[model samples]
Target chain A: MDATPQMTCQTAREAFPEFLDFRTAPTARMAERSHLAVCPDCQREFATLTRIATALDEAPSALPSGRMRQRFYAMLEEEKHSARSIHLAAEREHHARGLSLWRRLGLPLAGCALLAAGFVGGTRFSARSPESQDHSDPEARRQLADLQQRVNAMGQLVGYSLIQQRHSPTVDRLQGVLTSASRENPPPQVINELISALALDPSAHVRLSALDGLAAHLEQEVVRAGVLACLAREENPLVQVSMIDLLATARDASARPAIEKLSTNVTTDRNVRDAARRALAQL
Target chain B: MLAVRDGELNALGELFERHHGRLYGFLLKLTGDRSTAEDLTQTVFQRMLKYRHTYRDQGNFAAWMYHLARRCTADHVRRSSAAPRPIDPADLNLHADDAPHAAGQASVHDDHRLLYAALALLDRDDREVLLLSRFQELSFAEIAGILECSVGAAKVRAHRALRELRDAFFRLQRPTPPVS
Candidate 1:
């Protein structure tokens, strides 16, 4: 018990070897424990180390202050707002870039995107011409460049006509209206719009045409969600199969509940249900 | 999962209010920094949000949260403390807490401070196992789940961590750290 300071440090060094093998060495353990029975130095060291370890566990920590929490949350909100603004600005810039090419032909595609407005409770409204809205007006360029300032005012998103108009380009213009439409187009919506246009077109051939264009974009989660929603309700088995096939491309686990429900529906064709199950497994 | 997916801010705020204290205390102990622990705690919740869909049930929520927290903590420790050239004296900083063994330094109060400083020297993993087992009141199975090890391995780990901790205490000039 009366070991020199150097002697105790040496004994502690020897004891550490047991700790090195502490996970597996049975003999090292016995030796260390036996040494602890007579050596007060080792015991003291052991006590101090564990006490800090435990006290740390028990020590109380304050939750972030309300101000800090607000600051963090506000910062997140700011990020989201900036993200949205940037998205909108990009879409505008895309349209603007596309229109710049069209405006070279002196056509009014800028007015066409703005022509989406339906006024006075479901009635169509267009005033005079862009030239009168005044073509000479300095604001005319601002109006043409105003995509960035604009917001999506269509609450229900039923303006599929503008989309149909936007996409159906005439071969007379071989350069075609590149319509920054390709630029900031939300890839998911572009797919769904194509699918909807294909399904509802007067000519079933165009519906098939729409499918070819949409098929390339089908391999993503957000796009698949729209396809699945349409498929679950589609009476046409052929369209249902196409939607089911598209679901195979989505990695979304959120589709499980819907897929599970579809699995049990007896009225659905056996072939379609089997496909849904197989696709469900992939997700 | 409901608190996360439903975007229920109140629900998430309550969850943060309930769990943040323990997570901060545990991470601070593991990393030994207030700011890093704070940032890591926030990162854990952000991760919880990112992978919310994988959550099946809330039955073992605490264990699951700790599972993610401990994994991230281990990664942090690994990045912060890398293995250097062969076991030099500096590598044995963990074992050197028992020094400055002057006589009569082992008072009831010294016993308190000595254990505190000694713990800072133990490897982060051993410190984690000891803290979770003894203070968090997690069972060996839960500890295994949190530590991502088997129950048998967790018991062995606990024993080993406790022994190393005991040795570290002796090196600190304290007689014996009181057992829980």
Candidate 2:
């Protein structure tokens, strides 16, 4: 009796596809080869299948034009450039926050301490003679103005710190920040912080607050540019609608092209398309 | 690829250089239009960058790439208003132009043309399995992963597609019967 199992013609024909695989086991390949030697039909079918496989392997691959490579590299360069800019901006914002902390809290606290000491001394001196305490003194007016300025600085610092707090739940912190920022004549640092939040914050609600906080400052070129950039990358429909509305409200003609593209984009949300059309009309 | 996932953006350029030709070939076979293949090739790489973080260290990059390529092709098909253009046999460049002229050369060229025409006649899924298995030289396991099927199923599909292609080739080769 033969030690190896003999492959039948049907089996050999079925195994022809597996034989096309270079990885087929040698034992199985030998069995199929033995069958093919004796079986003319299997041989013919196997030969045709082998030829087909070879032709597939030898099929000439089409090469993409040079423009494809150029376009890919260009896109990669744009991504790298945008990533670098975001990284640099985050770093600058980090440094600015550190400096602003000292300037807002450190300097104001120091001035407050000095004013307290001066006030205690003045009180002690006036206690020594009530008649010498003059309300009309220019020195007293100067100290009052200085105290008021420091107190205002301290208030702005507290508001900015609330906006920067990462520990608080995003919604709560953003709400606090927005409330503080909505005050009349918010400081420039507050506006900058709001713009940073609008651009970098992950939460849509937080971004909306930041956008609202920035509403009063949209006249500033930096704020308008920041909002426009946010619109370009903004994916969330609600955020996109809000951004389009804000841009249109500002009458920013520069955003017309982006808005027009959004209006015509078939992939954009239906509501967003409608909003974009309305905004385009306004623009 | 791990480096690309870890923010080394330039590492992707190396990957692109290495795989772009084969990737373009696969897309060309799938799309049958050079310009569409070129556009989809760029789209696949763009998606690789966009979805790099999803790449697993243990996963095959080629398989992942074909996964993306399949998606890009599908998206392109879905977005386009027209059906895919059938592949022209001439575009395959299968003729042995450089070979010394011989009696068998013309028959070989005709066979090549018939084979490509048969390939174009196959169902899209059959053509894709054939392309991935034979043209790309991917293993059954890799094809299984890309096609989201079992390895056995991938092998079966490839075999069936090959048989159909062979039948079509012979059908094209047969002389027309005289009209009664």
The lDDT per prediction is 0.56, 0.80
Every candidate's CA RMSD: 20.6, 10.2
lDDT of 2 at B173: 86
lDDT tens digits, residues A219-261, model 1?
6554566555656556655665566666666565666777677
Residue B16, model 2: Cα distance from true site in angstroms: 2.1
Give the candidate number with the greatest DockQ.
2
Once superposed on the true structure, which residue ranges of model 2 sit more than 4 Å away at CA? A1-14, A28-41, A123-283, B81-83, B89-105
Error of 2 at A16 (Å): 3.3
TM-score of each model, paired residue for residue: 0.41, 0.64
Per residue, candidate 1 scores C-alpha lDDT tens digits across B1-180 of 575555443455567667876776566556656566677777776666666667667447777677778877767767776321111111122213434345653453355454545557777778778767664445667888777789877767776676676676668674557899
Per-prediction fnat: 0.08, 0.54
Q: lDDT by residue for model 2 over B1-180, one digit each (tens)? A: 999899899999999999998999888877778889889899999998888889998778998999899888888877894445656555553325534257876666677667777887888788889888885457788999999999888988998888888888889889889999
Docking class of 1: incorrect
